[model samples]
Target: MTATPRPGRTIALVSEHASPLAVLGGVDAGGQNVHVAHLAAALADHGHHVTVYTRQDAPHLPPRVALRPGVDVRHVPAGPPRHIPKDQLLPHMEQFGHFLADEWRHRPPDIIHSHFWMSGIAALAAARELGLPLVHTYHALGTVKRRHQRQEDTSPPDRIALEKAVGHGCDRIIATCRDEVRELAAMGIAADRTTIVPCGVDTTVFTPHGPAAPRPPRRHRLLQIGRLVKRKGAALSITALTALPGTELLIAGGPPPHQLHQDPEVRRLRETARRTGVADRVRFTGGLPRESIPALLRSADVVLCPADYEPFGIVPLEAMGCGTPVVATATGGHLDTVADPATGRLFTPGDPAALARAVTALLADPARRAACGAAGRRRVLTRYGWDQVAAATWDVYHDVLALHPSHPSRGRSEVTPGPAR
Candidate 1:
C-alpha cells in the first residue's frame, strides 16, 4: 500500500532541455515547457514545495529563481552555460548526473520526476546513488520520431537504447496518451508499471467568453500553432490553404517575432506558400506572447493541427477550451482527444486534400462549427483541467515514494560540506 503524502513535502522536477523559465514557441520550447511550468505551479498550489531543476542555458541567469509562492527554479550547471540544441546535450548527461548527485547530498527531495529521456538518464543515476524513487515522463519517444522523420530525424543514435534503460529503471512511467503506452510496450516497459496522465489546459485562461485577437478580414480563418518544424506539418497546412478559396491560414510560432525571417523552417514554409499560390492568403505571426494565445485561438474560425505525429497535443485542447473547433490529423493523441464531427474533425496524416475538405466543411456551416466548439469546450472542462492533471500526477509521486522509502544516511558524504554556491 502507498504511504500518505505529508504536507510541505519537496518534489524535484528534472527537465534538462525544456526550462520552465524559457519563452514558449522557440525550437526547444513548446509543449514540454508549458507542461512542466503548469504542472509545477499546480503541484505547488496543492501545498507541496516544488523545485524545478533545469539546464542553465544562459550565463546571466542566477543559479536559483523563485517561480511562484512555493515553487523555485534551480539552474543546474551542465555543458556550456549557453543555448545548445537538445540533440547535442545528450553527451553531457554524465556531467548533469554528477551535478545532481552533489546537489542532492545537501538537500534531497522526497521524489524526483524526470521529464524527457535525457533528464531521465541524469535523474536515474542520482536516484540510484541516493536510493530515492524516480518517476519518468517521456514527452516524445525517439523510436516514434525516427520512424516518422526517417533520414530527417536528428536524434542521437543511442537514444532508443538509453530510453529503454530509463523506462526499465524508473519506479513509475507516466504515458501522456494511450498511443504512448503501445510504444512503451514495444520498448519492453510493462503495462502494469505505466499510467496514462494526459496533458491539460488552463480553462480559466482559455475560455469561450474572451475578446478575440484582431486579424485581417477573410471569409473564414484557419489557424495553425506550433514549432515551425517539418514533422509538425505546417507546410501541409499551407498547401491545404490553396484549396480553401476564401479562407486565410494563420501560422503562429517559430523563432521570436524579430528573428522569424532568419528561421530556416520559416523560410522553407514561405517558399511553399508562394509555390502553392497562397502567399498572400497565409500570414506568419512569429511567437506571440503566451498570454495572447487564448485570444488567438478564439479568433480562429477553425484551428488546425497537421502534425505527422504527436505524443499529446496541448494546442487542440487549448482551442477546444476557447470553444473553437479544431481540425487535426488522425494520429497520436489526436485520435484520443478529437471526436469526429462532434468536438472537431480529423483527417489522415500528411494529406492536404483531406485537411482542406474538413476545413471547408466546417467553414461552410456556422451552426455546426459552433456546436462542435461547444462540445469541445465541454470536453476540456470535464476532462483536461490542470487541477485534475496535477492530482493524477501527485498520485503517481506518492505511489513511487511509498514503494521506495528514502535512505537519508546513504547519500551524505563523510567529507566536510562545501559552500552552497
Candidate 2:
C-alpha cells in the first residue's frame, strides 16, 4: 500500500538567539544554527511555508531576507543591533515578543515552534496574545548544564524554573534525544508531552567522496571541530595527545587565524600543548570556511567530540557521514548516535585517559577503523539525514495543530500517527 503524503502547514520557527542565517562556528553559532537552517530548508522542501524569526544581531541585516524558495528569515529587533552573548539575550526577550506579536498581528502562522529555551520564552509572550498553540524544542536544558558545569554554568538563576514554566506553556515539546526526554520527565513534564527527533546532517555536503583537505604526511591525524568553548574538550584532546606521539591534532573553529593568538582559549590550549611538550604537534586553523569542513573531516584519521556533556551532538553525525570513525564522550546523544563497536568508540566524558585509550585502540587497528567508518556512513545515510529529522518535527507540529481548537484538523477521527523513531 502507498503511504499517503503528509500535508504541509505554515510554520513560524522562533529561534530568537540561534538564527538560521548566522555564520557557523562562533561561540553562539554551532548545532542550533545548523539545526534551524537545515530544518527550515527541509520543511520548505516538503512544501511548507517557513518563517524563521531570529534576533537582528547586526545593523546591516535586512528585516526579512529570503533564505530559499518558500522560506523567509525575519529578523526581529530586540536588543541593540549588535552582537550580544546568548546568556545576556534574556533581558531583551520581552521586547522580542512585542515585535513578534506585532508581526503576527499582520500575518499569523498556523503554528509556532520554538528552537531553544529563550525562544520559547519569547514565543510564549507573543503566542499568548493570539492563543496560538505553540510547540517547543529545548536544545539544551539549564538543569543539565548546571549538572555538568555547576558554578561555571552561566545560565540565569531562574533558568530552570523558567524552562519548566515554558515547557508547561507549550502545547507539545519536541526533544532532540532520549536523554532530554528523561530529564524533562524528572522536571515533572510527562513523557507523553515530549517527542524525540535527533538533529540531522546534510548528507550532500558531508560525504565520504569529498576532496580531502591537504595535510603534510604524519604518523596519524586527529581533528576536532566546533566552537572553542572549554566544555567542547579541546584541552582534553590536547591532553590526550600527550599519550600519542607523532599524532598531530588540528583544532578548528575560533577567531580568524590573524586574531587566533588573541583568543584566550586558544592561548590556554597552546599553553597546555607547550606544558605537555606537544606544542609542535598541535595546530590551530582558526575558524574555517564552511566548504573546508567536509574536507577537514575527510582528511582526519579519527574525529573527536569529547564534550563534558552533549545534548545531541551534530559533529559526530557529520563525522560519521564523512566515513570517519569518531571517539566521542559517551554521554547524552553520543549514546544514541555512535554505535560504539559498530560505528565508533564512546569513552567516559571528561576523562583524558579514556579518550586516549579509545583513540589508540581505533588507530592501532586499521581494519576495525575502516569497518567502523563504513558502518558509520551507512548509519548516517539510513537514519540521520535532514529529511528524516524534518518529517519527524513536522509530525509533532501536525499533531499539535490537529488537536488544537484553532486548527482546521480538529474533530477529525484520527490524525496521522507520529513519525518513526
Best by lDDT: 1
- Pick out the ten consecutive residues of candidate 1 with the lowest summed lDDT: 412-421
Error of 2 at 50 (Å): 0.6
- Per-residue lDDT tens digits for candidate 2, residues 1-421, read 1122255668999998888877677898989989998999998998889999999999999999999998899989988999999888878888888898888888899889998988888887777767777899999999999998999988877777778878877788999888999999999998998988899999999999969998878579999999999999999999999999779999999888899989999999999999999999999999887888999999999999999999989999999999999999988989999997899999998899999999999899989989999999999999999998887887887787777866422321111111112
* Per-prediction TM-score to the true structure, in the order listed: 0.95, 0.95
lDDT of each: 0.88, 0.87
Predicted structure 2, TM vs. truth: 0.95
Q: Report residue 56 deviation for candidate 1 (angstroms).
A: 0.5
Residue 136 CA error for candidate 2 (Å)?
Answer: 0.7
Native-to-model Cα distance after best TM-score fit, residue 271 in candidate 2, in Å: 0.6
Off by over 4 Å in 1: 1-5, 405-421
- lDDT by residue (350-395, candidate 1, tens digit) is 8999999999899999999999999999999998999889888988
Pairs of residues at least 3 apart in sequence or in different chains that clash in candidate 1: none
